[model samples]
Target: MPAERQTETIDGHEVSLSKPDKVMYPDAGYTKADVVGYYRRIAPIILPHLRDRPVTRIRYPNGTGTRPFYEKNAPAGTPDWVRLATLSTPGSSKGRDTADFPVVEDTATLVWLANLAALELHTTQWMIGDDGETRRPDRLVADLDPGEHTGIEDCVEVALLLRERLASDGLTAYAKSSGKKGLHICCPISGEQSDGDVSAYAKALAKELEVERPELVTANMLKKERDGKIFIDWSQNNAAKTTVAPYSLRGLGVPTVSAPMTWDEVEAVRELRFTPDEVFERVDEGGDLWEPMLERGPKVPEVEAPKRRKRAARPRS
Candidate 1:
């Protein structure tokens, strides 16, 4: 009988699931069953997008005692439609099993996951910014957390301004909420660029933005320094830094907040109207608005630096 599984009640629904050997789901309210059911309901929709893509699975606890998280491929005998992965925090921490979903590499897989999350959880929120033109297949995303405020409108403004500056250089960008107190701005780059190159580009962009709008944007990583401002976190582009996978569930115990949005809507929002409780409802009603953007070309510009004007020698003083 389906391996005599465990079950739990979430939002008053009985969800069936199998527990990880040593891991635990982050949210106290969600049972192992709920987690498994979540995967099952969305698996079919996600598989076609992930077929034949090279993937890297991030294990929860990622070491001895932690369960193996599979990515890129489903576990042996599992259906091809099931794109499951395991993830663990470093050193095999027990409590960290909270964030152990396998991350699929294909963009289509991610989009499907996003759609499912939006449909089931009711947390579809969109943020469009000025860098709409810079969208590309190869992307570098940095999650800029604005602690305490978590205001979607404020975050969108930051994203738009960043887009404007990047657009001048012919780069395209997009932004979304973290489903928490910050935003994620993804820049399109030539996939040809390495992590280092992406980091360089992001750092330069953040630095330039900080220079132009010091009051609003800071590239600093220190929380104390970033008080009341958005930090342009370039570190996320580093191979070691992990930004939220597009559709992956967060550790918040509730459905995550990030949602794909159209540039026009991003510019139109007075504030974030969506919430986690409403994510699934919104998806059921309608899904992502930024899907078209996924297929668009890189929009970065090619411009040469201006020559410095040599000053004529004044009278020898």
Candidate 2:
């Protein structure tokens, strides 16, 4: 029998969905149709974050329980209606110089991706300019990843400290769940600073936090160093890197979304993970919590590197 196929007109664009009944999330029993529907409903709010950014998708063609692969370039057979961006990715492990990445500018493109089982949509800190070139970073992110024996509560503690630290520099911070096991603190910038400048500021801030609370936070990227603390991953601000886009679904055991949070919720830190249905309800009740990051804001302030206390050398016997 021929594979079942269906077409839907979204935003005046017709998109085809294959295997709409195929289960993408085995644990949650969510099908390809469910994924496409979620993206269609979420497009109104998520488009801003994805509009001009080149998306990197993590595809699970065999369902979330099976192997997954990262797709940076627009896959073969991509619809011509889908917007494309030719980006220069220097030092890419794949050894490619330039890649044609997909830019999700509308609901149809998003639905297309969902049909491919692209559960996770990741984006860089920079945006594509009107000339189709990558621009300076307009936002900064600090990913609070928990280590062994640490959890969301630990990330919340670090996030609050980061909020205060960023406030001291005159920048407002927003909080969100990583949709997996971490928390993301983001702030909008004026789009005037280079990726290096923004990354330096983020690194400096993370280092400062590490110094302020050595036992609770670690700026070091080494997993061993994060045994009992939240690792402040400021490297995600690099131009070449991509963080999971807010409202994107994760390919975890269950269907969880990268949901934005209010400071009060962050403070409470009880329920950080949210399912797709719950996220839709959240949008109905609270609107977009990540909307504040869409506005133009101040530049990232230059931060002085905090001096680390030197470790005492052990005398050889």
Candidate 3:
């Protein structure tokens, strides 16, 4: 039997969890309490990836597989103790010039999000600096997604190509499942490069891969050309774009996690899907595989900016 509601002190803050036994993952029978427990246990590892990042949460209030909402602004009634980052979104469609997004700094905050059924936590490549503004992107990502008639195996092959290409450029690539039908190859980068520079570098690499293996890979985003190919989505490195934070859960009617993997695991992976229990077991055997991504490294290789074509002179009137 589970309590209908209860209060627990986490990191010096009291959080009230209600309907602990309510199933959040109806397929897996995972309840709200279970979600809270997972975040509590995974906090130490997950927080590093989340710290200083403004999270955009995908909330499934009624439970996974149900109608969900994407929450960018900090929800009303957020605890005063939780840190908020106010970002200026000029020309915004939401009709607000600024958004108060929550930054998870401690276990209590994570638990609070879990209580809200925020299963998917997405974040940008950059972190908020001490000055309370977004810093230069410190990470670059190549999101390799398999298209129709393709699957994990195709993604793995493309990832291997990426690993080799990155190594040749003196970059170390880290692998992680997208918790869906894709893989994300991340590299720690020196924060010296501008966000646009980093994104350009990623775009260059993706184009290079596409050239080398045209059959297995495609850098284009067109759906018609994606079938039977791996789409290397370099745009995820853009300053405004968000990728699923490592260790966050996916609401695919199951309790799958976006888990990090070693190069060895990536090389030999038959299936990229990993449930919460499997992730815990892997963590126990091998510490946080994503820890290395926090370190500063060399800047991404410079890319040649695309040359602008000259406009034709207007005909003499």
Mark the 10 consecutive residues where model 2 has the least summed lDDT: 297-306
Q: Sort by lDDT, best first.
A: 2, 3, 1
Candidate 3 residues lying further than 4 Å off, grouped into runs, are none
Tens-digit per-residue lDDT, 74-187, candidate 1:
233332443443422343334453232333433333333322221222111111113312212255666666644445566677888877877777766676655556667776
Q: What overall lDDT goes with each candidate model?
A: 0.48, 0.91, 0.90
Better of 1 and 2 by lDDT: 2
For residues 64-171, write the lDDT of model 2, one tens digit per residue: 999999999888999889999998878877899989999999989999999999999999888898776656888999999999998778888899999999998889
Write down the TM-score of every candidate.
0.58, 0.93, 0.97
**Model 3 over residues 36-121: C-alpha lDDT tens digits?**
98999999999999988999999999898689988889988999999999997667679898899899989999999999999999
Deviation from native of the Cα of residue 209 in model 2, angstroms: 1.0
Clashing pairs in 2: none
Number of clashes recorded per candidate:
29, 0, 0
Better of 1 and 2 by TM-score: 2
Model 2 segments more than 4 A misplaced: 1-3, 304-317
After superposition, the stretches of candidate 1 with alpha carbons farther than 4 Å from their true spots are 1-16, 19-28, 43-137, 147-151, 268-277, 290-296, 299-317
From the highest TM-score down, the ranking of the candidates is 3, 2, 1
Give every collision pair in model 3.
none
